[model samples]
Target: MNPETLLLMGLGAVVIIAAARWIGARTGLPAAALLAVAGIVYAVLPGPNISLDPHIVLTFVLPPLLYSAALESSLLAIRANLRIVIGLSVLLVFATALLVGAGFGLFVAGATFAAGVAVGAAVAPPDPVAALAVGRKVGLPPRLVTIIQGEGLLNDATALTILNVAVAAAVSGHFSLPKAAGLFVLAAAGGTAVGVGVAYLVRLLRPLARDPLLANAISLATPFVAYYIGEQLHVSGVLAVVVAGLIVGHDTPRSGTGASRLQTNAVWRLVDFLLEGIVFLLIGQQLPAVMRGLAKYQTSTVVIAVAVTVGVTLLLRPVWLSLTQAAHLLLRREDEGLNAREIAALSWAGTRGVISLAAVFTLPLTTGAGEPFPDRDLLLFCTFVVVLVTLVGQGLTFAPLVRRLGLRANEVDEARQRNEARMASVHAALERLDDLEEDEPGDAPTIEALRGRMQERLRRYEHRLDVLQSAESDEVPVSEHYESALRIQRLAIEAQREELLRWRDAGNLPDEGLRRLERELDHEERVLPDRRE
Candidate 1:
């Protein structure tokens, strides 16, 4: 809580996250699941434990994470599957909450219908972070990834809106379906407007954003600004963050300078790494708080409540997806329905996460008349169990399930498509260079050099295409001799870099000259694929 302790916790979290990443890579484990387990273990082991503040997580943590995800997501992919995304994000979320609420009200002792709905709303929206992390590692089909991302990006708004209404009903001892519907519509519409307005305002200030530092800074601040403005206007801040992210991400190629795009992406990756690690760890640390007042309820009650809630959460997703696919087939009559394997993967991928915990923890401590909120602690416990079941349980098994279902993407075909596009672009550029060479005789030598390099690149791409077309599997095997040539080039670059540094140190070259020369070497290295394809 103190500054010193907070600093200490921050360092510790980083170390643990680094370890999680290392272990995850080697063992094929989900980092989220591993971090969560470690947190729970630490909580029970007798050292300092951090309790999650719902306000801090909801406001400070949620915005940037959501924005980062939205920025990275493919806008075109999401739009192509907009109908399915809407079904999953909006319709599925509503259905899950209502069904869970009804079941909880009937089965859980001392739970009012409003209290049950509040808890239901908390666990309805699947968290995208864990699901995306695993899905990408396992190479899920691009369409499925887009669906998961779209659902995750937008579903929080739907669930939170429902949760707010449910909590108000519980607190005020009043409930009105019509009013809630109107409020939902108002919040959604207002949030979208705020997001669009903020994005356009940011675009108008493009002159200020040309500097890489300023651009990255503005990007970092943009989500918070959107969220705060939406909240101030009594709208859905979460939706505003998502909307802004989607729009900004789609426009980034056209709007950002090359340096700004590169720097911004690197910074956001670090932010995401730190934030996601801390969130899952905090989730594990919540066990003590969630279980504190839970003893008041019967063991059988907790068991029944958790079982029914978890069962409903898992069962409803596949059923909903199946029905939607069926409807799409029956009516639309054009788009292909998802295969059984895809449906199952998508269904299992709907794992609830931190947003659920934060929302439920925000339930009022007491009603307006000063009575204790009905079944508040019980609801908290149930919500935690739901998150654990869906997030940890499902996250840990997601990749394996996909593998068993035989749903891996065709990497070979994807690679071939990329090579074909690369070859086409190269040919177009070569044509332009020829025109320029003819028009500007003074630049003939420079143009010839450029044309020669491009033609070589064009040939390499054509060779890659031929190899891919002939290959039977996903493996892109580079010859060891070619790798040796690349290594030698890298060594030559390093030698040049060391000589440049020596010249600068000896006062023969100024720092600016050193940088300008270093950039040329940097560009050469950038052209090499340092990582495996």
Candidate 2:
């Protein structure tokens, strides 16, 4: 395609993405699924369509997306659910691959066990983007959200490693259990090390990245650095990127200033929004490419291949979660474990996405001896089928499933906990003011003024907490006075912003000065909770 065509396609994709996002917000559907449908519609219309390049997706697209997710995820929550995360991310992926491999090897004609396993590996990891977006919107409980996030963050590494090992075995016509296990171990360890090293390197450079622009520059580069270094070292680049993101995210609050944090967050949000939307569209557009190689295979053969993959990929998750949950219940003395509803919800959330397509696209056309890779085209179709089925089918229905199961989060309790935390922070501030009052000479008026403001904030929190605790239902009780106060504060901020704009328009204030003052108002407005009265 020419540059003009590419540019037009890019712009077209943005338009579709924006439309999908708007529709999703209104209809409570996943934008990812919507974008996929739109792409498919466009693909079938006899126009130029984009084919997914695995190298481009893996190297350029995957890192930043993973990094952004890792940054937003709670490291502590993931650690708490580490066992379940491991079960889903690693053990489940391996088991699914083995099961699918066995199915294809025994049931599907002319398919090798290694090639079957390669397809299994491709479809193993669930992409958390769609699920997380819908889950948070529907107020899924924090524990469930953490599990999904943890699994998504870590599972790519496992699936990609298995895919690589399976591909190598298929290419060389050699398969050894011990060697495969050894390779997986080496990749995991090396990737983890590289990720940790990159995170520490970032920490050492935090002082230099204190400026918002510089911080964004470093943040943008961190994932690629981790991925590139890991790939160069013959380790798992996916794991490296994820690990670096998690560690850097965990340390971000302690290391960066408020402005840096704000700017970095805004940048990553835009990156994630654009990248995720384009990726889903890209996935749908590849239907033409995926279908092109299936002419040689018998109709029945293609149907059976698609069924084996779709069946194994969809059914294996719930069964695996049930078995793992049972095993945990049997072994543990603790009263805590996933109940039936939680398990059901988690099972339904296993929607595959771009990583599956990217991994499969990386499959080579020929083996080491120059023979065609067994069932290469068939495998691609199966992977694409699996992605389409899960991403669109499950993505669309997951929220409804959660609702049917009566699994919505307790928002009132969550608000109460947050208010309590705010109360404690205010107490700490008051204590600090006391110390400063004793130490500082001739700052009595300023300190006293600060103390009054802190006291007022503490009172507001206490009142909110009291109202929350006294609530009779799960819904948060909205105080009219509180809502009115917030609205007034918002209006005040808006008026100040208007004045700043007016000054800039009249040339009384420079653009830079106006921007600086407007930023202050933005932050102030951001601090207020949205009650949407």
Candidate 3:
């Protein structure tokens, strides 16, 4: 495609993404699913289409998306749920791949185990984008959210490693369990080391990253840098991006300036919005490409292949979760195990996505002996079917399933915790004011006024906490005063903004001065808690 054509395509994609997001917001459907559907619609139409380049998607696209998710995820929460995360991301992935591979090899007529395993690895990892998007909107419990996020962040690396091994075995007509195991360990360990080293290196450069522009640049570049280093060292680049994101996110608060942090965050949010939208759309467009090669296969063969891949992908998740929970119970682990409802919810949340399609699309056209890679086209079609079923089928229903399960976050409790933390912070501020008052002799009145403000804030938090404690259910209590106060504050800020605009219009205030004041108000409004909450 020419530059002009590509530019037009990009613009069209943005329009579709915006429309999907708007519709999803109103209908309570997942935007990811809607976008995928839109892409399918586009693909079936007469216009030009883009084929999914797995190499480009894996190298350029996957890193930043994983990193952004990692940055937003809570390190402490993931650590707390380490066992379940591992079970899902690592062990469960392996089991699913093996089971799916076995099913395919035995059932599908000409499919070899290695070729089956190649596709198995592709479909094993659940793309949590659609699930997490809906889960957060529906208010899933914090622990469930953490597990989903952790699994999504880590599972790609495992799946990709498995895929690579399976591909090598199929190509060379040889398979070595010991060598594969060693390779996995090396990848995991090396990826972790590279991630840590990159993160700490960024930490050391914190002084230079204090400028907002510089910080955004460094933050944007970090993921690709880590990915490149890991790949060069023959490690798992996906894991490296994720690990670096987690560490950098953890260190950001202490190492970064407020302005730089704010700017970097906004930049990343935009990056995430565009990249995810493009990726999901790209997935749908692959329909024509994947289907074109499937004409050679018999109808029964196609049916059987699809059934084996889709069936294993869907059915095995719940069974695996139940088995893991049983094992955890038998071992008497200290952590509380998942209940039946949570298990069902998590099982349904196993929606595959772009990564599956991308990984499968990377299959080599021919093996080492110059013969065609056995069942490569069939594998591609099956992988696409898995992605479509899980992505659109499960993504659309995940929210309703969670609702039926009655698995929602405890908003009242969560709000109370946040209020309690606010109270503690206010108390600390008051203590600092006292120290300042003692050290700076002439600032007594200033200190007194600051103390009064903090005292009032503390009192409000205490009252909110009391109301939350006495709530009849998990619903966050409605506070008329709090809502009215928020409205008044917003109005006051709006009025101030209008006055500044008037001043600038009259040539009394410069544009630069108006922007500086406007930014201050914007930050103030940003800090306000959402009224809908």
- Write the residue-wise lDDT of candidate 2 on 445-482 in tens digits: 99999999999999998998989999898778889989
Worst 10 residues of 2 by lDDT: 172-181
- Give each model's whole-structure lDDT: 0.87, 0.91, 0.92
Model 2 root-mean-square deviation:
1.3
What is residue 200's positional error in candidate 1, in angstroms?
Answer: 1.4
Model 1 scores worst on lDDT over the 10 consecutive residues at 524-533
Overall local distance difference test of candidate 2 = 0.91
User: Candidate 2 vs candidate 3: which has greater lDDT?
Assistant: 3
Instruction: Write one digit per residue (lDDT tens) for candidate 1, span 472-529.
Output: 7765555465577679989999999999999999999999999999988997887775
Score candidate 3 by lDDT.
0.92
What is the Cα-based TM-score of model 1?
A: 0.94
Full candidate order by lDDT, most accurate first: 3, 2, 1
Q: Which regions of candidate 2 fall more than 4 Å away from where they truly are?
A: 333-335
Q: Write the per-residue lDDT of candidate 3 for residues 184-257, one digit (tens) a residue.
A: 88999999999999999999989988899999999999999999999999999899999999999999999878
- Which residue pairs show collisions in model 2? none
